[model samples]
Target: MQKIAIIDYNMGNLHSVERAVSHAAAGNATVAITSDPDMILKADRVVFPGQGAARDCMRELETRGMAEVVREVIQTKPFLGICMGMQVLMQHSEENGGIECLGLYEGNVRYFGTVHQDIGVRLKIPQMGWNQVWQQMEHPLWKGIPDGARFYFVHSYYVEPQTPDLIAGSTEYGISYASAIARDNVFAIQAHPEKSADDGLKLLGNFVAWQP
Candidate 1:
């Protein structure tokens, strides 16, 4: 059976993530929420899930000695980063003045400001609902999920990857922005698949079965 580690840094309610992933795995894998670097490194796949502030997330990761562990595992493991997990993979974030992230990908997370608008309606910050994701690149994580599928999202921030080719998916609030990124064995998404219903569940199931 596969061993999956959901790296815990006390950022968000991991219970939902755990339940969703567990439902997806369906007893075929052993899913664990662990902060121990050794256990994370030993897992067949590692999931990084987070919410709340980037500064707090980064601080926890660095202080707990998990930051370097994440950097090390990225090169070899099948890694999945969700929400703040995905944001931290970037070089920086414009949240809380400015935050330095894990820098796995060269990008910056920016807040959705008042300048954003769509169809004469002022787009809201936090974007607290569903938006359609357009596939930006072919990747394992997109398997069985149709292009332009709607995923649940709740964030005031978004990512802009320096390398365009690293983008796996895009979504438009006021402008087109990356919602997912992929490279090598790493795939990270800004939206929460756990709250996304059917398509969300399908995506999680794909991750559970993905060979890449």
Candidate 2:
């Protein structure tokens, strides 16, 4: 049984994610939904999930003494970030007056802006519900998942990775954004895998069996 720590940053859906991992790992996995640094460092695998503004999430992480802990996890262990969790890995974000982030990845978060706003097509800014993701490349993190599988997404901001090959999959929302990424020990996703049904479970299962 893998010790998967589902980080409780107070900004993401934590419980369901833990459950999904438990099912995927097929073992007596432990899920700790806490901001405690010690618990995070002790875990075999760390999962960072988010569902809010990037700036606020960073603020909470810093306040909870998780900033340094997360930095260490990504530096030394297999780490996964989701949604705003992925955005926080970048050098900075333009979410609220341009705040600095964890600097794990060399890129900035950007919005859809007026590209779709003025066209009157009115594609939802948050990009909610299920969407198919085309596999940009092969990644061990996506072992059992097929190419162009549908996953659930709900976010207004998206990642534009400087290392494009780090991107494992992409989803279209007027424009394409990196929906899944894998860079050495670090893995991230813009979609909520825990909510994507069987496909999501398979993705989690792959992550559980993946090697850093």
TM-score of each prediction? 0.95, 0.93
Query: Model 1 compared with the native: what TM-score?
Result: 0.95
Q: What TM-score does candidate 2 get on C-alpha atoms?
A: 0.93
In the range 41-127, model 2's lDDT, one tens digit per residue, is: 989889999888877898899998888899998988888887887888888777787889998888878776644764556677778
Q: Residue 46 error for model 1, in Å?
A: 0.6
Any idea what lDDT model 2 has?
A: 0.83
Off by over 4 Å in 1: 114-121
Local accuracy of candidate 1 as per-residue lDDT tens digits, 70-103? 9999899888899998999999999999998888
Candidate 1: lDDT over CA atoms? 0.89
